[model samples]
Target: MIINKILNVDDYYFDVFMSISESLTGFSVNELQSTGLAEIYYKHILGQIEAATFTEFLNISKNILENSYTQDQLNNAIAAEIFANASTEDIANSIITLWYLGTWEGAYVNDLSYKEGLVWNVMHSHPPGAKQPGYKSWGVKPVNSNI
Candidate 1:
């Protein structure tokens, strides 16, 4: 889609985004995409006209990864980049939060699971206001026995 162009980042950038995002959020790239976190992140950045900020963040991060710097140096620099500008910082947090919770920061928690969001999947529960597990399913103890 056009997002592929708007993001316009190289494979290196995507790889880094996936790596650092995984490291920061503890979610696999598959989870991110399956939960629509990636798309939401793109929409959030594009909505804020912060795509350039994201691109710049990725560029800087990739550069750091390619350097002979210490992990502390890389981590510190990336942290600085994210926090250096409030706008980029917001975007950065939004990306991580989206991956973890499957929703935007300002959005209602229920709205996050409006569809088959990651939270519901990970929690083994249905989305709030979407559907119930059936009237007695909640009390059924789930069949697997592991909770």
Candidate 2:
């Protein structure tokens, strides 16, 4: 990938990547970073997409985030600037899917990706057989405070 070829691991690209992901996924940077999959996902995306396309996408996202003052404004800008383009829309969707499902286009990125998926936390559940909610725990309704 061009990013890996040119930029070091500690480059600002990763910070930009995480910020874009936070906007796309509606998850905080801390939450996404806690998954321990940011670098993996960043490299995976760079490998899948052309360098110019990825760079353009990130640049647009950065601009939108910078120019928008409120969260609603930011979201509107992202919708207009990022998701409005076909290629960028696909990349954005892939990013959201990567966060929620830990899969890129239906294929798991890594073994840990599945176990660390955001969907589990969102649903207040664990990946079956991985975390094991406990024997027969499914029989009881989930105690979701938010609900």
Candidate 3:
């Protein structure tokens, strides 16, 4: 008997995270996973829930991970807010900023994933019909190629 393999929820989350990161930053899982910011964000996600709720937590985590923030601006804003007794307005602003940051990051990740996916699709696609003499010549060729 043969056993079929299936991706677990955690695996799926990681896959999605990697895909988004690659799309946004051109970094692979191995490279980005250890980055200081990524690690901090990852720990934040991991610490917020138990194992049983991992799948549900993953959606929110994914959103956070994929969100983008300008390093300089985020650092400045964080520094300013670090010692202040934040008011409701400040808190609201912070939340809004974070949400926007997440969206920006998500878009970057999505764009990179889209670009990589397009490349992959083009590389592995099948023509609608039988292979023709000129079928393989359709893609963008190198300038140096003597086609």
Candidate 4:
């Protein structure tokens, strides 16, 4: 029998949370990491939900990731396994909202979170106040903007 020894427990949990977030949000690990909110989100989740529920959710996510064969299969598994349950669904939804809107339960985590929201990038734009595209830039078609 192999023994599991995790010296850095927080890091391990963060890794698992990140993997689950990647699957739930359809974003790459790098993209999630780029936001610099992985740890913050993890902490927020831990604070918002019970520890036992979060642990079980992580385990289910691990199993789903291990068993899934394709994107469609993974999505199906996620919907059936995660979204079907009320507690897990709440957590999953919160995670998605956090990524897209940079808020947890309708409250922004921080200034960086507002600026780094994935929705802005998904639309090939930046936050309104932060990262302004320059004066009158909107009048001309953006170069190489696929959108």
* Model 1 stretches astray by more than 4 angstroms: 1-16, 64-87, 108-113, 116-124, 131-136, 140-147
Ranking by lDDT: 2, 4, 1, 3
Q: Of the candidates numbered 3 and 4, which has the greater TM-score value?
A: 4
How do all models score by TM-score? 0.55, 0.85, 0.23, 0.83
lDDT of 2: 0.83
Instruction: Itemize residue pairs with steric clashes in candidate 1.
Output: none
lDDT of 4 by residue, 35-94 (tens): 887777788888887998999998888788778878888889999999999988988998
TM-score of 1: 0.55
TM-score for model 4? Answer: 0.83
The parts of candidate 4 lying over 4 Å away from their true place are: 1-10, 134-136, 142-147
How large an RMSD does model 2 have?
5.1
Candidate number that wins on TM-score, 1 or 3: 1
Q: Which candidate is the best by TM-score?
A: 2
Superior by lDDT: candidate 1 or candidate 3: 1
- Lowest lDDT block of 10, candidate 1: 1-10
| Candidate 2 structure quality by residue, lDDT tens digits, 1-147 | 011222246656677788878888888888997988988999998898898888988888777767877889988898898888998899899999998999998999998899999999989889987888989886777876543
lDDT of 1 at 76: 73
Clashing pairs in 3: 23-112, 23-113, 67-102, 67-105, 68-105
RMSD of each: 6.3, 5.1, 16.2, 4.3
lDDT of each: 0.59, 0.83, 0.37, 0.82
Model 3, residue 125: what's the lDDT? 39
